[model samples]
Target: MLFGKKKDKVHFNPGNRDDGSHEQEIDKDYVEEEVNKIEEDDVEVVLNNEENIDKKFSGNNTLSKYVELGRIMISMLKDVKNGNYKNIPWFTIATIVMALLYVLNPMDIVPDFIPGLGYIDDVAVLTMGVGWIESDLHRYLDWRMENDMGI
Candidate 1:
């Protein structure tokens, strides 16, 4: 009982079923529940750990492709925090936060210590989050360009 309350472990199934058996995809309901729990402090934690997250992406071949998207999400969150961007929906912000949190967590669905396929779940979560907020992300990109905000 030294570490306060125990955090609930949530698993994200990467759906890597090469066999003929059906596998459940990443649980959207679980993700939504986590997103709903996002608070200002959570946003700050992600923003503060941005460099660490970037290092993880840069060091991994599979996660490298998502570095740009991760940066964009962080940028969007920064803008939202600064009150410079008001066009984004709360859902988009929450989703971005949730994805970043997942990426930052090394002991997630797939532990980051595993070689070869450690970051697969992280990639899956990032891809899923981007898909959900693609339009809002695009709009944010456009706004950034129009307002001379560097990516």
Candidate 2:
């Protein structure tokens, strides 16, 4: 119900508008509701589409900044799947999956086909997701180092 019965797609637009009028504010509650719906299979889809996701990130300079962080997030999910790491909370995992899913979708808020401006929202989502999960991510990093898991 997040996209009015459009189960396959979700989009978000944030910040001020060009005409000096607020178009729409991101519905945080709705977003949280949808993100919480994400499951392990959803995360697996993102992992399975890693090639396409990497292409999307590498195709845009702005999105490229998030590539490393995205990799780390994906790695953490893989670790959780393999039972190699379980310190992360499900909410954190869900958040990461949501962000990755957002990135994988080309027809997002701004539509990736548009040059220059398309990736702005993606960067925002990735940045927000990272901010939300920073502590858990750091813990995962520490655990990664201790386990000699190179990333």
Candidate 3:
């Protein structure tokens, strides 16, 4: 077996330092662009997975799951309109964004194109939002505590 050479850990010092060196900075925008590029490829791979194209969840199929989730999100919005999740507007908004991101993630568990892992990632993100929703239930319940129909 060939042994690989180990790299030394980076050391940084602000003053009294020899061999003055600075970390190369990567542009945040460039990094984000690269990440988006990779995700797009992942989406293509997921879309091409034949085995993952027909999986079923609940009373609907995988594609249906995404649509159903969208409907549920609308219902959640109605709940918000009625004032269910209060005092946690940021949390609700973040949760909504995460949910949307998950829905938009084409490469998921079993690789939807692969037959099993295709929808896994989306499901995982959804599960996380659900858990957060549950933990933040009190905030929502508080919102439901009163109706200021004076508007």
Candidate 4:
């Protein structure tokens, strides 16, 4: 909550460039434009919001969707941590943060080891977390596009 209050005025590093390319191997500019964006703002910018939750859970809560999404989210985290999924910088940042939380907090909605049952809650929450991260990344990507950056 404290971070939320000061998000509008806080900006993190603005010129740190990474060595990454997109799937097409295109050299994404990926420059830090420092548009008055803050650390907390960047975090939210990389994540999806409540609206996405409604959409993702709109029609029906299928088990398979959860399984597939969970796998993808997990894979994304692994890639980010391993330096493979390097294109989505903001997304990677969010994923890494969420993974840290998941590891530190033991009281998640679902137990971490009840086979398929335990996975239900974990997948849902993690999927949402990744979505938020993705949203934040999109915000930055849009900024990049508008500025004609390669990102």
Candidate 5:
């Protein structure tokens, strides 16, 4: 009661077979939802907040890297939405949008207001996300340069 509501626990058995074979359970907290449930207004709010978050970190040398990554992702989001780029899968866009929302979200694993440590988690999330879609992002960048869209 002191720490707040407990998170719902979810489990997965990666090695489990359809025939009900023995397997190890992976225990992790899970959040259930669909992207369609996220409102357009929330997306816009996250987009707008990006600028403020950037300004907050601009003065910090280390946090600047995280801020720049956020900018690049936002730019890609814009290009994708404007139809300036194509061949990108919907799930990729969804994942990027979700990451954007996560970075801008104030209530995360660590609160964003805590001077030095707050953004570590944000950066980690962004880093993992970038790693996850690095190939897609590279393809986008190559396409942008080839088509003169980067200019």
Candidate 6:
């Protein structure tokens, strides 16, 4: 409706002609609808691939580091969720969740099923996340040490 009156049908030119009289006029609504449809489909694909990445990669040579990162991520999330890690910003929690989600996603920067290189992207993303909240993670670690909350 933002485009004012609607035409019953509109013709689209494949390309610009030399005369330039028949220039393409794309409907904004049509473009927007197509983009939204594509995005929705992509989200569905991502959701379908969300599963346990650890189980798939647990036996991998490079999995130890990822498993440790997973433990740290889980601990951080639990602390935040249980109110043990108070005053944390919502964006921090969101970032952690996004990293975890990426790890769980089978199709990411590099597909997780690839032999010998599947977890490279996962490590990169998780490491970036660890760096992003370095100070917060340190604070939580210190708190745990002070409170004697081992494990």
Full-model lDDT for every candidate: 0.77, 0.73, 0.41, 0.40, 0.57, 0.54
Higher lDDT: candidate 1 or 5?
1
Candidate 6: which stretches are off by over 4 Å? 1-57
Q: Estimate each model's TM-score.
A: 0.81, 0.78, 0.39, 0.32, 0.66, 0.61
Tens digit of lDDT per residue, candidate 2, span 1-151?
Answer: 2111223333334334334322123345565676778866787887898777777788656556688888888888888777788776667777888888988888988898887877777777777677667899999999999988798
Q: Give the per-residue lDDT of model 6 (tens digit) for 1-151.
A: 2112122332223243333221123232342233223322333333344335446546776577777666665675666545676755444454455566667778976898887777777766666556556677788778879888974
Give lDDT tens digits, candidate 3, residues 3-91. 11122222212244223221112222332333233322332343343223223333346457545544444344445444553344433
For model 6, name the residue pairs that clash: none
C-alpha lDDT of residue 46 in model 6: 31
As a TM-score, model 3 comes out at 0.39
Candidate 1 wrong stretches, greater than 4 Å: 1-24
Candidate 4: Cα lDDT at 33: 23
Worst 10 contiguous positions by lDDT, candidate 3: 1-10
Q: What count of clashes does model 6 give?
A: 0
lDDT of 2 at 61: 69
Candidates 1 and 2, the one with greater lDDT: 1
Listed per model in order, the count of residue pairs whose N, CA or C atoms clash below 3 Å is: 0, 0, 15, 12, 0, 0
Top candidate (TM-score): 1
Candidates 1 and 4 compared: the better one by lDDT is 1
| lDDT for each residue of candidate 5 in 1-151, tens digit (9 for 90 to 100) | 2112122322222233333311112111121132223444554565677677567557679777767767776777677656676666554555466567767677787798887877766665565556546788888778878877642
Candidate no. 4 TM-score:
0.32
What value of lDDT does candidate 6 attain over all alpha carbons?
A: 0.54
* CA shift of 18, model 4, Å: 34
